[model samples]
Target: MRLYWTMPDELRIHYKNVLQKYNEEFTKGNLSVAWRHLERAHILGQPWPREHNYVHWLMLKFGIHIKDKKEIIGQIPRLLIGGIKVSLRRTAS
Candidate 1:
């Protein structure tokens, strides 16, 4: 199994805080707020493969929870390719 590790500490703190907000809002049934947090988490983690993929996975789950076909479909490609893109960007830089 390929193990994806955590992001650097600078980004990790903010990424984790955003995910924490996502969880809290999701638990409260505040879906829009939860999605907003997810987007923020995605932005914060965009440079790291593990964090990027993890956020997309969460997005996929959220889409399924809400039964949104568009989001579910969208997240699929993101989940699969986002980490690859991040890795490539890091390598090319």
Candidate 2:
């Protein structure tokens, strides 16, 4: 989606932090974490986040409008690789 507003450097920083947390929670398959981050981001004045952001949050929050096939299936193997990195660190410990 298109960003509708231009703000101060601080707001930009907040946006980046929110986006980062969103990615972190999304990759961990934690919808609650994702939603909270979005809420916080919105409170901080971020706008029109993104399709993936809203889609994943809605799927968890209300469990509605989740019907339809999408063209982008996401990178599962990438997630698997990230998981492997964590697993390897755990095994080492």
Candidate 3:
């Protein structure tokens, strides 16, 4: 999905709000909520893999690097499995 960078002011505002909420959720240890907001941010931003800002920020947030097509694909299953394992451990304890 390609989102034009020339988004409306309202959409930009909404995006910023979502980002703030995402950060808040992360700080509060709400990984699921944070992930939801991050997903929304990714959709709204439509960041290209080569975009430095997006890639850097996402890497900082998720602790994963996507330096190439292969790296991006490799991260999918790892992220899912890690998320599931974390969720299960959270629930079990």
Please tell me which predicted candidate would have the highest lDDT against the true structure: 1
Cα lDDT computed for each candidate against the true fold:
0.88, 0.49, 0.55
lDDT value for candidate 1?
A: 0.88
lDDT, candidate 3, at 57: 58
* lDDT of model number 3: 0.55
Model 1 Cα RMSD, 1 decimal: 3.6
Model 2 Cα lDDT, one tens digit per residue, 1-93: 233324467676977788688669867878678767756765554233232344334333323322233412332332335334434444455
Candidate order (TM-score): 1, 3, 2
Residue-level lDDT of model 3, residues 9-57, one tens digit each, is 7666877787889779878878778778877876665422222234235
Evaluate residue 68 in candidate 3 and report its C-alpha lDDT on the 0 to 100 scale: 55
Give residue 41's lDDT in candidate 3 (0 to 100): 73
- Model 2: lDDT of residue 69: 32
**Candidate 1 versus the native: TM-score?**
0.90
Error (Å) of candidate 2 at residue 28 is: 0.7
Candidates arranged by lDDT, highest first:
1, 3, 2
Q: Candidate 3: TM-score?
A: 0.51
Tell me the lDDT of model 2 at 44.
Answer: 58
